[model samples]
Target: ILHVTLTERRKEYEKAKERDAELRNLRDTAKLQEFFLQEIQLGELWLARGEHKKSIEHLTNAIAVCTDPNKLIEVLEDTLPPHVFEMLVHSIPYTLQV
Candidate 1:
C-alpha cells in the first residue's frame, strides 16, 4: 500500500512540474516571438543588401530559437536565393530548439 501511494504521489509531482513549465513557456511566448521576428527581419535585410555572411549569422540565430525550424527552413528555401539558402543550411547549428 505504501509503495503504491508513493508511486502515485511521484506521478502527480511530475505532472505538476510539467504544468509549471508549460505556464512559464506561455509567459515567455511574446518575448520569443519578438526576438524571432527581429532575427528574421535582420537576416532578410542583410541578404537583400548582399551581405551573405551577416545574413547567415542572423538567419542561423533565428533558426536556433525557432520552435518549428523545419517549417521555417521550408519558407526560407522558397523565399531566398538558392545559394543563400544553402549557406544558411550550412551555418545553422545542429542544436536547434525544435
Candidate 2:
C-alpha cells in the first residue's frame, strides 16, 4: 500500500509539473502579445503625427515579435479604426525597406 501511494504521488507530481510548464508558456506568450500590441499602437501614433521613420521602427519591432501574423492582423482589425488600420498596412512596405 505504501509503494502504491508513492507511485500515485509521483504521477500527480509529474502532472503538476506539466501543468506548471504550460502555464508558464501561456504567461510568456501573453506578455509577447501585449508587447506586440503596444508597439503597433506606438507606431500608429507616430504615423498620425507624420513621423514615418519612427512609425516604421515601431511597426518593424511589432512585426518581429509577432508569433502569429493572422492573430496580429485580427487584433489590429478589431481594435483600430479603418483609416488607422489602413495606414498601418500601408506602412509595412516602407518598413521592410528600413
Worst 10-residue lDDT window for candidate 2 reads: 79-88
Query: So what's the TM-score on candidate 2?
Result: 0.66
Q: Which candidate leads the pack in lDDT?
A: 1
Specify the highest-TM-score model's number.
1
Give one digit per residue, the lDDT tens place, for model 2 in 6-80.
Answer: 999999999999999999999999999899889989978987897866776787679767877667667777866
Report the Cα lDDT for residue 71, model 2.
77
Superposing every Cα of model 1 onto the true structure, what RMSD results?
5.5
Question: Candidates' TM-scores?
Answer: 0.68, 0.66
lDDT of 1 by residue, 10-98 (tens): 99999999999999998799789899999999998999899988998888888888999899999999999999998888777543534
User: What C-alpha lDDT, on a 0 to 100 scale, does residue 11 get in candidate 1?
Assistant: 100
Global lDDT of each candidate: 0.89, 0.79
Error of 2 at 58 (Å): 0.9
